[model samples]
Target: MHRLPPYRLRRSARAKYLRLLIRPEGIEVVAPDGLPESTVLAFVRQHSGWAQAKLAELQARLAKLRQGQAERFPAEGGSVPLEGRETPLFIEETGGSRIRVSLEDRGLRLILPRACGAERDRYVRDALFGWMKRRLPGRVAECVQRHGPQHGLYPRQLRIKSMRTRWGSCGPANDVNLNWLLGLAPPSVLEYVVVHELCHIRHRNHSRDFWELVSAHLPDWRQERQWLKTHGGGLIQRFDPVFP
Candidate 1:
């Protein structure tokens, strides 16, 4: 039998089955309480190849994250993504309680309190999200209006919220819920998620019919989806602290 490498083990009362997680720090095993240590070791050995591959992937992702951390937000001259393009963020003190933001010459200018302290990042994040909330509905509505008629699907209600694990969801009564995080993705990626959820109105599940409908409208949706899968984590990591 192959000896299992050293790994952290956690027992969970609510866990129904054993699970392995590869993290930046190391591999962690989560098992139900009272699971025998020998069984855990056997499971680790059974999936050693998968565990090794996942560990390497985690290392690569951590390296990318460390590189990305150098690019912080709300600095004197930082950059923020707007519709997938990197636009310059300019901060100017206006000596007022109100924070104002504007777009000019392909850049974003923020007019904010001159004496903003530690809360400045929070203020900027809130203001930017406010702007996105006000603007995203219209953008989503436009995408729906453009594509809904073709697929014979229209949502009765569209709701936007901050989500942790999903980009969008389709619910009863033809309601579609979109994550505010979509604003951070490229416009094409956001459209893909919108079309994806809208297709659910026709086919309730991720069945062949649902994907066919999505493909009929956006042929290059796979590329957009892949882009989200690869780059979306950074956006979420960057803003999660603000939202949390």
Candidate 2:
């Protein structure tokens, strides 16, 4: 008889019988009543090596993900990838209580309060992101006023969300939600995103009507869209905003 990989078995009253499920995490075994001890032991004996190999693969992938997360931010005197090159961040102590981030002398400058410590990195990151969050609503409102009337589309409500995967989203109810991270992109990209969401007010899906609406307000919207798509990973990766 052909051998199968070793797997754990869990008893569930709701289960009809023995079941197998394969997932990215691993394979699972479920039995309604119970599996015989001899059968379980035999299964393990038959494919112990395969099980061990699968377990090792999963652990390696997890280790890589954890390592990537830690290395997301560069160390002092180290550089982080920005645009197409590695850009260095110059940290300085300033008298101001609030932290500020600005581009200076071909490098990114982070001016932190004099009271800074190990916690200062998270604090400054939040401070800069908070500024973006605070300004997003007004920027959306302005975009609505400028483009809404022209397209005969208006948002019932505008909101900001800390979404992980999108620049903005529109609802069937005409509500608009913009990703707080959009503020990190260049100004034109932000405008393109705003217009994109407002266009959803008229067309919910990415249909011809939607593209037409987006083009009507922003003729060069496609270029900006491409720029953001290619460069957006840097925006979220740059801050690694610590959520409280």
Candidate 3:
């Protein structure tokens, strides 16, 4: 028999019988309380065909998303979305070891020391990314204070950094980590991310109660989340350029 995708068996008291559910995380097998491990495996084996088909669909969807993302990467000296606007980029080489990215009246002004080809690209990428990080803490501090009190959740510390695969994460220690790329997204998107992480401070898991809390604050969170899934990939690839 063909094996199923990665799955975990859960014993739920509310489960009347063994049932297989496909979720974003993976396949979940909910068995009635006191079901033996062997019985759960047998139940999963019977649904292998169904689970494999579903996961293959997921793979196809992911591949399509990546293909769409590839078409959106911003080229150097090209425009990129900054603060919800398509900001132009300008690069200039000057004599010095100083590398800086500045926002001028026209667009972003990148000052690079004598560098060429791949080296130049690296400097441009790093300077823009570093500038974004430095600019994020102040941008988000007000947001945290604005939303934290209403929900009664306050993070002990707030940090903004580059996380390739995550938008934000709330640690158990009451520290919230927001992605630096969020500074490029619209203010609404940034606000949504802040609220999401703040909610995590109270609800560690995405149970029904957790989602209710999220919905209460941001009724349109699903829309913002979908936007991230579709457009966020391009931003990620833009920051992570291949150098050889």
Per-residue lDDT of 73-164 in model 1, one digit per residue for the tens?
Answer: 44666777888777888888777687888888958888779778767777777777777778799999999998999968899999877776
Name the runs in model 2 displaced over 4 angstroms.
1-116, 241-244
- Candidates 1 and 2 compared: the better one by TM-score is 1
lDDT of each: 0.83, 0.71, 0.82
In order of appearance, the predictions have TM-scores of 0.67, 0.55, 0.67
Listed per model in order, the count of residue pairs whose N, CA or C atoms clash below 3 Å is 0, 0, 0
In model 3, pairs of residues that clash are none
lDDT of 2 by residue, 1-244 (tens): 5555646667788987555554456666666666676665565566566666777788788889967756555445545443235667677777868677675676766677878776765765665556566667787777778888996888788887777778888888988888776766666787888899888877778998889888889999989989877877766675654444
Instruction: Report the Cα lDDT for candidate 3.
Output: 0.82
The model with the greater lDDT, 1 or 2, is: 1
In angstroms, how far off is 203's CA in candidate 2?
1.2
Q: Which pairs clash in the backbone of model 2? A: none
Per-residue lDDT of candidate 3, residues 149-242 (tens digit): 8879888899887788889999989899998889888888898898888899989988988888888888998998988998898777776555
Poorest stretch of ten by lDDT in candidate 2 = 75-84
RMSD of each: 13.6, 11.5, 18.3
